[model samples]
Target: MKYWLGLDCGGTFIKAGLYDLQGNELGIARRNLAIIAPQPGWAERDMPALWQTAAAVIREVLELFGIKATAVQGVGISAQGKGLFLLDRQGQPLGNAMLSSDQRALALVQAWQKAGIPQALYEQTRQTLWTGHPVSLLRWVKQHQPERYRQIGSVLMAHDYLRYCLTGELACEETNISESNLYQMARGRYEPALAQLLGIGEIVAALPPIVGSAEVAGRVNSSAAAATGLLAGTPVVGGLFDVVSTALCAGLQDETRLNAVMGTWSVTSGISQTIETGFDHPFVYGRHAEAGQYIVHEASPTSAANLEWFCQQWGMHDYRQLNQWVAALPKAGSQLLFAPFLYGSNAGLGLCASFYGMQAFHQREHLVQAIFEGVVFCHMTHLKRMLQRFPHTRALRVTGGPAKSAPWMQMLADVSGLPLELPQVEETGCLGAAMAAMVGTGAFPDFTAAQQALAPRLESVQPDAQAQAAYQHKYQRYQALIGALQTLQSGHSKEAL
Candidate 1:
């Protein structure tokens, strides 16, 4: 039987899997990858080491299944969005990849915003001035590492870098390219004007050719085949940013559908044909892998990361135990508040995880519950913004690590007052990549056909009306607290400016 491969390159791991065209998952392999913290507010990955690990995992999966390299039809990639992986003339990684958590780019993004660059940027890309975006990181590189920047031949994200390593061609997929802040969303292409504004136009030759997320990127190289155990002539498709692929895999393809992907960070996205954005409240919109469609996304910089942080602080080991302990607590266990800004603000500023309203009687359980509540509350804020702007969403599809927890899924459903549908496949990013491959390889007539065939069975979770009512009251308090926090922030900004 023929098989298709889907690979997911995440911040912490590289996961690969083999599947049939009918969506029966054969096997999945995951290998841990390291994130190097060279300095505070900066995260990176050793690009060469990561590539080797990816190949190792792919080879292992194929061997385990007793399948030859020639049996694989096509390959698709899905990776964490943002970050920069610079390549040299010989297609070698120049240095460690600058991760999405890196803040060295913040100052440059701020300067662009001040110079009216972000305004033009928003008009083109629907993005705000945020750190970890490629535009900000690229500008930082040009200003701070001119010598190293001079050697750069092309810029690729995590998956794009992997694609280049496997295929000799260098190309950027649309979903990730649009997040670069240098790509024009409406026009669906890179902006030369923005590159000139940043004074990096001379090196524009290094930028990857932008292509559809499901388009054929290239054939595998002999070196890649030796390392990954894939056929040399096997086709590799341009993959997508994790978010877009997750949405597609979870069946959030229509304009009226939305998805909540819970991982280290929580991302909320929807499929929209039109761009819905504004000054104070706006979202990044970009073209979908499926032609004529666009994706509208809002992200909470930290969700599971905050949970992980709290677990460490409390010395908890198992998350299942942690969940049970928190669930046993009374609803709204403590009066404490947590803003969950461990990764800084993706929305607005001053969202740091707070322990406000804490009393002398509170314990770790209450604090943990408070943090969980705060994360869910923050998600609800995004949901409100999304629904208000679009107002046509049918249901919210929830996917990823946290979605596996019944308590967490139900709590989110209750807090958001929407039904949460969990995909049959927990790893939608990988499955989405497989779907893209199938479409690109002509196993299916079109993206819609591929989606229909691979769209997993969705497990439904509905809000408990009583629990929903309780969360509604807490949500009001949450809004009031956010307002108060914003006032404090304004006062502080006034002093600083």
Candidate 2:
């Protein structure tokens, strides 16, 4: 039987899966990588360390399955988005990889906005101008490190860079290239005008050629085979940003279906037959695997990441214990509401996390519950906007780290007023990549066929009416808290007079 490989490169770890044509799992391996947070609002990863760990997991998965590299049909890769990886003329990494969450580019973004580029930027990129974008960072680099910037010959996203190492080819997939702020979403290519407007026209020269996802860019090289224990000529197919891969894994190809990937951050995505732009629905839109299709997605920058911060502040050990503690709390525990915007939000400006009705009597569980509730509240806001855009959504599909917990899933269903379907395998990103590779190399006819043949089991979670009703009341309080926070932030700015 033929086999395929799928790998997911995340901020916290890299996961690999080996599967046969039947979609039955043959083997799986994972390697955790270190996240370097040298200063506030900055997240970095050591490129060498990440590549070494990824290579180790690839070898281990192949060895565990006793598969020859030449025997494998193809490989698919899904990776975290918005990371900046610069390479010199010889393809050597220039500096630490800047994560999607890094905010050092804020000054540059401000300057661009002041120059009256925000609306035009949105028109071109379909993404809000923000500090986390590669375009902003590239401009920042030109201003701060002209010497380092001049040595660059290629710049790729996290997975694109790794693909280069494996295939000895330099190219960026459409979904990823869209994040660079240089991409014209409607045109489906990089915009030279935007680059020139941003005063970083030369930076585009370092970018890789854009390619369609599922295209076989090249075959693995001899050195890669030795390090990864695979056949030298194994084909590598195009994959996408980790979020889109996760959406694909959860069966989000249909225009009426939506997906919520609740991990460190949370994202709500759905397929749009055509790009639609309007009030309060600014989103990052990309093309689907098929020609002439688009994927409309909006993200909440602080979801589970907010929960992690609460746990750390309260000295909790892990999410399970913290979740359990929160689950046991009384209804409307502490009456303390959180806005879920600790990391600033992608939704709108002046939104910040706030604590309403806090008291000295409140305990750690109350705080934890509030954190989770805040995230659910944010998702509900997005869900409302999504339904407005796509009024035909029948059900909601969820997949990610937090989706594994029963209480969290229940809370999501209860809070969002939508039934949730959870896949048996939470590692859908890797599986989706594997499926893409399978089809890209003809192991399967297409995605629909692959889903029926190889997709894992799924279980549905329905909302409990009682809990839903109770959360409904708290949901009102949550909305009020958001408005009050916005008012407070606005008042603070005006008070400077």
C-alpha local distance difference test of each model: 0.81, 0.79
Per-residue C-alpha lDDT of model 2 across residues 251-273, encoded as one tens digit per residue: 77676678888876678888767
Q: Could you give the C-alpha RMSD of every candidate to the true structure, in order shown?
A: 2.2, 2.5
Sliding window of 10 residues with minimal summed lDDT for model 1:
345-354
Candidate 2, residue 5: the lDDT equals 87
**Candidate that would win on lDDT:** 1
The TM-score, computed over Cα atoms with residue i paired to residue i, of candidate 1 is: 0.94
In candidate 1, which residue pairs clash? 153-206, 154-206, 339-354, 340-353
For every model shown, what is its TM-score relative to the native structure?
0.94, 0.92
lDDT of 2 at 278: 67
